[model samples]
Target: MNLLRAAATVSSYTLLSRVTGLIRDVLIARAFGAGSITDAFWVAFRIPNLLRRLFAEGAFAQAFVPILGETKSTRTTEEARVLLDRVASLLTFVLIGVTLVGIIAAPLVVSAMGSGLRGADRASDFDAAVWMTRVMFPYITCMSLVAFASGVLNTWRHFAVPAITPVLLNLSMIAASIFLAPRLETPIYALAIGVVIGGVAQLAVQFAALARLGLKPRISFRLKTAWADPTVKRIMRQMLPATVGVSVAQLSLLINTNIATWLAPGSVTWLSFADRLMEFPTALLGAALSTVLLPSLSQAHAAGRKEDYSALLDWGLRLTLLLGLPAGLGLALMSEGLVSTLFHYGAFNAADVAQTRMAVIAYAVGLLGLLAVKILAPGFYARQDIRTPVKIALAVLVATQCLNLIFVPYLHHAGLALSIGLGACINALALLTGLRRRGVYVPSKGWGTFFMKLLVALAVMGTALAGANTFIDWLAMQQHAWLRVGLLLAMVSGAGVVYFGVLFTLGFRPNQFKKGGTPLV
Candidate 1:
């Protein structure tokens, strides 16, 4: 399969998900605004959302996909199918227990996640958060299964299903926000309901795809039998270190969320909104590319094709810089324009936009680092070396908290964003160094020239974006909403043209990526 084409397919579908997600956030902002109520919902939503990342997207995907590739190559079809059944059974049983615990302990979990909500004046908000948490807890189970199916499909070279399934969740939320938020005594509960509904829809579609491909897992109740399978045990063992790595990241996020709750009324919501903006490039470039790279990296490693493995990493790294730099520049320089245009209406006021803009600018500081880690960490994961990343993540977690102490005192929520970004940069550098020391990856020829061209392109793009920011006051343009949207679009489009045009003038060609697989040009 062409790597570029596969990545494009994933990115395209992911773009749809992000667009729908933006609409969801926009509606929520218009309806609810950034306040204690919105904060309650955001804090509650983070629970299942974090677990979805931890289990479904993070540890499970990392541990399961490598082994699945091995099974398909080394085992008989019957054995591979059984492996799926056993793994799925074990995951299902475990998450069901977790869901039950989460529902029963909703108050405790919410308190731990956002202690500020526990204040006397904010007692009702805390209760609302707990209530929403209970309602959304089941979302984890459905999403984890969805992740299982996504891993299966991606390994089977069907990337579109996994990429597109997220749209269901976004659409579900949009519908609930529109139809349900106003009807209830507490409007946010509708979003929690939408979470579960979306999860079911995503899983149903993914399972349907898996069934069509003859890869659907037969979940069983025999815990003993599923646990006894050596491959199942092996995946569990691999998941141990993978979980630690993922948990460390999630733990940092939990701490950050808790800190945000204490700092101000809407800090959590502001940072979360800023996060929605950041996810666009991260999802489109980083996630979309990594989704295609990880499975291929595993396959290449299993076959003992060292050069192919290195080449794949090389391609991902170069592509990350080719696109990621300009993305970061756009984000950092056009923060006011982007934040205001997307979110500055109704309850999302001028103050909210300014606060969110600060966080967005701070996040842009580490955007490239964040994008690079998506490529570099897979270099370790594909080799089944989860321990290295775990250790690095632990260190980064400590570093992040320390930075948070210094930053939170001054920059408040934006400080948290900055710390997370810098920590990502640190993690990416460490991962790259480890890959180099292990002789797993060596830089290819023309890296210096490539770096120089990117620097040139980024400078040109940055200047264009910065100039465009001066022409219109994003906040002042709010009454003329369509004009703000038009100006933002033209600015971004013009910047992209200038950036790539400079790269082409300086000897960059889109067609160069097609030599191995897929024409990215």
Candidate 2:
């Protein structure tokens, strides 16, 4: 696989999804605003969403792809089909059982995630959280199946459908928010319904694609036999560490949510909104690079092309820094403007924008670290070394909890943002250090020069944003919000132009960093 081409394709589709998600969040803010209801809804929704990320997206994908890629390479088509069928059967059974347990335990889960919602007056709020969670819990089951199918399709070199699946998920939510949200007695209920519907639709779309690939999965009680399969064991071996790593990450979020609940009414909503904004760059660039590079790296490693693996890893890291750094800087500089323009309408007031902006800026500080993990973690997974990440992730989680405790008291919701960001940086550093120790991350000759140029470009970008923010402030004094928004956007575009244009002029061609068969280091 051409890593760049795959990254481009996945990034394009993911960008579309992120854009739609932003729109959805904007609409959600307008309908629900930042309040007790929104907090309850977010807490409820986060439970399943967190599980989806931990189980399906993180652990499952990390494990499934490399094994599936190997299976496709060595096994006959018929043999691969049987392997997939057995794995799917077992996965479906496990996911269904987990979802049933989650539904049955919804109340306890809500209570754990939202300790603030106890007592006589807030009992109704706690009930809302439970109800919404039950409604949304089925999403975890559907999404897990979808993730498994996605792994299969990706291994088959069919990325478009899997990449596009999230777009359908976002669109489904957008439609429900637009039409169904207002009709419901509580808009949060509508959003909960949308979550479940989107997951089902996401799964259905991938199922259609699987059918086209002649790999339609069926639910079966075949676990007794399937669990004994060698390929399944290999997958499990890879999955175990990843499951722990992802669970640690999820637990960090759960901790943040639990803590945020104890803060002011809008704290959870503010954190969620800021998280969505930060995720745009993450989902677009970081996720795209990881998704595209993993399969390629796996194939390279399987082929014993250590040099190719190293070069690909270096190139991915450079690309991540190149894109993520400026995006983070821009978000940090324009956090207030972004929050004001995107959400400061209807029930979302100036205070809400201020709080969300703080969270957004704090999140921006950690953006590079998060992006680094997205790029770097794949190096271990692709090499079939998942255990190290789990170890590193555990350290990161402990660090995050410590930071959360230290900062949240002083900064409120924004402290949670800072803690998560710092933890991500620590995680990325640990992963990279481990890779170096393992001899999986040999430094490339161009890394020094590439990083030098990137830092220069980023410095220039920051200078431009500072100048533009000053100009925006001057314009804002005119008291025209629309003009301020337009000017701020223009300023951001101008910064991008200067940054990339200067980089190109300084001999920083994007293609120069592309990995060939040989390792540059």
Candidate 3:
């Protein structure tokens, strides 16, 4: 696959998914508001959502993909099919028990994730969250299957289907928030039910894609045989560290959520809204880059093409800094406008906008780091070196909790977001350092010049944003939604023109980014 084209493909689908998700959040904000009920739903949704990351996308995919790439590259089609079947069977058997246990322990899970919900004042909210968590627990099983199938599809270079599968989740949740919720006395449950529906839809699409690829994963419970497979043993071994490494950022966020629940009634909701905005670029660029990179990196590593591997890493880092810096800066400068324009409607009021904007700015500060980690961590995972990243992740997680103690007292929810950004930055840096120290990555020659150019471009963008914000008055534009959207579009377009225009003048060309078969040199 051409890494750039593949990444653009993934980013396009991810953008669609994120756009639909924003609509879902808009409806949800209108339907539930940013109070106890909405808080409860976020908490409930976060439970399974957390695992969906920790297991499905996090450790499981991280471990599965590298192994799958190696196996597919080295082994016969029949052998690869057998390996896929065993992995699928093992995941199905394990996650079924996990989901059942999660359902049974719903209340405990809720309490752990959102201790603030268990307060006497928030007892009803806590109970609602528990029920929602139970209802959504089964989603983990469906999503795990989706994750495995996606790894297979990605290794096979079928990117579009798996990329678009997330759109189903957004569509289902939007439908739930708009249609199903209004009919229910407690509307949050509808959103929780939507989680399961979305998961099933995501998995179903992947299965279809797999069938077309002529790959069928037979589900069996013959644990001894499956477990005895040497590749299965390696996956489990890698999975152990990969899980912790992949999950540290998420674990820190979960901790932040736990802390936020105690801060104010709308604390979790504000953070969630801000995070949703940050995720637009994070999911679009960060996820897409990582998704494309992992398989390419693995292939390069397996082929022992050291320069190709290092060049890919260099290209990705430059592109990340190129896109990530401006995205973060733009979000920070335009946080209030973006939040107000998108979410300041119906039940979401002025105070909600203010709080959410604060959190958004805080998150935007770390956008570069967050996006970098998505690319950087894969440097380790794609090489099947999970331990170093885990060590770095552990240190970052510990430091984040410490930062949380210092910042939350002053910045509240925004402080929590700042801590996450801080952790991501540290994690990305450490991963880069580890790669360099191990001689696994050699920085391209133009990096110093590239950074200088990026700094200049970002300065121009910042100046442009400050001037626009002076007259735009995003909050006032809320009364004229079209004008708000139009002006916002204008600001983004102008900023993009300045940033990329500068890059072009600096002699950055589209041809610099070529298909994966080509090296940066």
lDDT for each candidate structure? 0.92, 0.85, 0.89
Question: Model 1: runs farther than 4 Å from truth?
Answer: 515-521
- Sorted by TM-score, highest first, which candidate order results? 1, 3, 2
- Write down the RMSD of candidate 2 (Cα, Å): 2.2
**For this target, which candidate reaches the highest TM-score against the unseen true structure?**
1
Query: For model 3, how many clashes?
Result: 0
| Model 2 regions lying over 4 Å from their true place | 473-485, 514-521
Candidate 3 ranges beyond 4 A from true positions: 515-517
lDDT (10s digit) by residue, model 2, range 4-122: 77778888888888888888998888877899989889999899888889888899899989888887777799888888888898888888899999999999999888888775777
**Residue 108 of candidate 3: its Cα lDDT?**
93
Candidate 1, residue 314: lDDT: 91
Models 1 onward score TM values of: 0.98, 0.96, 0.98
lDDT of 1 by residue, 1-521 (tens): 78888889999999999999999999888888899999999999999989989998999999999999888878798888899999999999999999999999999999999998999999999999999999999999999999999999988889999999999999999999899888998888999999899999999999999999888999899989999998888888989999999999999999999999998888999999999999999999999989999888988899898888888889999899888888888998999999899999998999999999999999999999999999999998888889999999999999999999889899999999999999999999999999999999988888899899999988888887777677778898889989989998999899989999999999888877754332221
Instruction: Report the C-alpha lDDT of model 3 over 75-136, residue by residue, as the tens digit.
Output: 99999999998999999989999999999999999999999999898899999999999999
RMSD of each: 1.5, 2.2, 1.4
Error of model 3, residue 345, in angstroms:
0.8
Least accurate 10 contiguous residues by lDDT in model 1: 512-521
